[model samples]
Target: MNERLLPVLDLVSSRTADSAWLTFTARLDTAHRADLRTARRLLAEFGAPTTNPHEGHDMPGMVTDEELAALRSASGAAFQRRASQHVRAHLEQAIRIGSAEQRAGVHPATTALATKVVRTGSAELTRLDRLDRTTAVNRDW
Candidate 1:
């Protein structure tokens, strides 16, 4: 593959492989996001809890009596407001880590794409990180 193709393939292939490795990572990620949404909805339905327990398959575990009390404290039409605040905070942390990684030499910044000078046909490459040892074939190619 050419220069442009290599990085694109590398990124896509990693995601594809990772997606398969963790079968439910993508699904769980989606559902985790949905938990925050459900949290809001549950806030509205807050009764004495003698009515509906509000349990679900993908919820963020059992809410303590204290937590229910906290959510109850917020007056007004505030539905699922806690979920929104928590989700935003979590996403902000992920974004900050991503930004730092981008600033570091990890990514091929700008597609200005300086040659990384990867040496081919090395026995060392064959013995490297991946236990699958695609590197042996890498040297062959």
Candidate 2:
């Protein structure tokens, strides 16, 4: 087991948890509101194992001040668009970090956790895509 991978896993899990928190707190439309709540619950459950005990470590993939401002200020379709983009980016980062952990030959527990994160991320990406398509179709009417 690579000792270095532990921090990576912790960082990825923390960042994912943070993203879920943001999504759950955001004022999303009915289409994604329930999903975000579910996502937050799952993230908190899965990400708990990898939480770093050390303080002051920067959370990777943390939303920038500007992005937070934009999301907070956005409304209607703009908010949906920004949220979608933010979620997609967060999933992508999780997938990448999970892959790295797998490749690093970390402990079986870590590998299993990483695998779960990747699978969850992929599913979320698919759901987001479906939601985007549905929104586009509705807009055509």
Candidate 3:
């Protein structure tokens, strides 16, 4: 999931006209990168298999290749709108997954990371909602 988010973050940062959205994307990028590092460290510490289970699966909140292609062709506000929508979906799905981990995960470190994921993702969702509201109001005026 973090791997998938990196390109979208770069795309949105490059094409978005909204400063707030750009900043949000940057924050997501940083958090996701940290999540990846934590995941790697945990895997090594516990000697768990490092294979990606979701590599080919259609996971929720994962943007499709076609969607990414379209995003690459978009510009300005269009890019921002689509990017925001995709990012919201991604965050929501991540939070759901994290919440599940928190409930059923056996490992202390893993569950702790899940808690952080839920907390951070929820905050990002709130920020995304505010940006949407502001964008809608600006469009109306």
Candidate 4:
């Protein structure tokens, strides 16, 4: 894993809850039939890796290739490329379609969670270089 991804790993780990699971579930609900079945199995195994003693750290925030493949299948090929534009936008697109069909409530919360999931997408690490300066320069720790 890239060092830059650590913050995202930490952020997601710290914040994960029903919303995160909801987003994950939403991804499943929207995924292609072929990909959805496999992704669920893989994620289940990853989430409960019998090899790892520590439960919390066992499954980090990183997305696997399988997950990406599933995401692409769910979002479509064109979306696969367009998703690089912004995580929030891509996820919003997913939620727009998924939630509307699935009838998930609390639109505001779902929208917020979608933003988080998108920000944590793979390139999110690379995006930090250009995206962080503004916040870093303004904030004091």
Candidate 5:
């Protein structure tokens, strides 16, 4: 999820003119990237590969190649709208997955990471929700 989300967040930050949205995306990008790094390191310590098994799968909030192309092709408002949708969906799914991992995962480090993911993702989701509401009221996109 972080792997997928990072690039989209980067794209959105580059395209969005809204200062609030930029700030939110930038912070999220930093946190998610850190999470991904920690996760990869944890897997490596256990002799497990860090490669994503969900690649090309139609899982919830998994962004498609076509969607990525659309995002890449779009400019300004179009990009912002598409990127916002993708980011929000990804955050929601990540929180859900993280919560499950926290409950079911046996590894102490992995479960700890999951707990952090859930906490951070939930906070960011609230921030995203507020940004969405503000954008909707402004209708600037």
Candidate 6:
């Protein structure tokens, strides 16, 4: 198993179909629908060990039951804040792991996937951050 890939795989596996993830997806605007779908597909791909023979064994940073409970209970802006924070942290970790994998000279396929994950995750994070800022500004008025 690629050490760099483990954290992301674990996160994906833990989050897929989980209540918090479902709630987050449900709350997202139509503008974010495509991105949410892409993220889910990517997570499914990473979570399936049989689909990627090189991957097995769990890693750190899997979302806990407690965190899911919190997300489930949150509403409106609070939900967005919580979901955005989690997404940002996940993206940041993916970026770091992907960069490390690139530096370490992993398999070309793995490297490519890592690159794609980082790029897509970064874009999503930026979009979410922008939305958050816009919401905050609107609330101040």
Output the better candidate (1/6) by TM-score: 6
TM-score per candidate: 0.25, 0.57, 0.93, 0.21, 0.91, 0.57
Pick the lDDT winner.
Answer: 3
Q: Tell me the tens digit of each residue's lDDT in model 2 across 20-133.
A: 323432322322344434444555766654443533333444445466566666554556566566667666776887889778944676677677667766876777787677
Where does candidate 3 stray beyond 4 Å? none
**Model 2 ranges off by over 4 Å:** 1-61
> What's model 3's lDDT at 108?
98
Backbone clashes in model 1: 1
lDDT of each: 0.31, 0.53, 0.87, 0.36, 0.83, 0.53
Candidate 5, pairs of clashing residues:
none
For model 2, what is the C-alpha lDDT against the true structure?
0.53
Model 1 per-residue lDDT at 64: 38
lDDT of 4 by residue, 18-113 (tens): 243334424423332333344345547556453434323413433344544444443322332222233333334443444453355354544444
Write the number of the candidate with greater lDDT, choosing between 1 and 4: 4
- Ten contiguous residues minimizing lDDT sum, candidate 3: 132-141
Model 3 C-alpha lDDT per residue in residues 39-116, reported as the tens digit of each score: 989999999889987886667798888888899999877787888888998999999999999999999999999999
lDDT of 4 at 65: 49
Q: Give the lowest summed-lDDT range of ten residues in model 6.
A: 1-10
TM-score of candidate 3 on Cα atoms, chains taken together:
0.93
Q: 23-101, model 1: which lDDT tens digit per residue?
A: 3223324433444344344445543233234433223323334544554454321312332233333334333433454
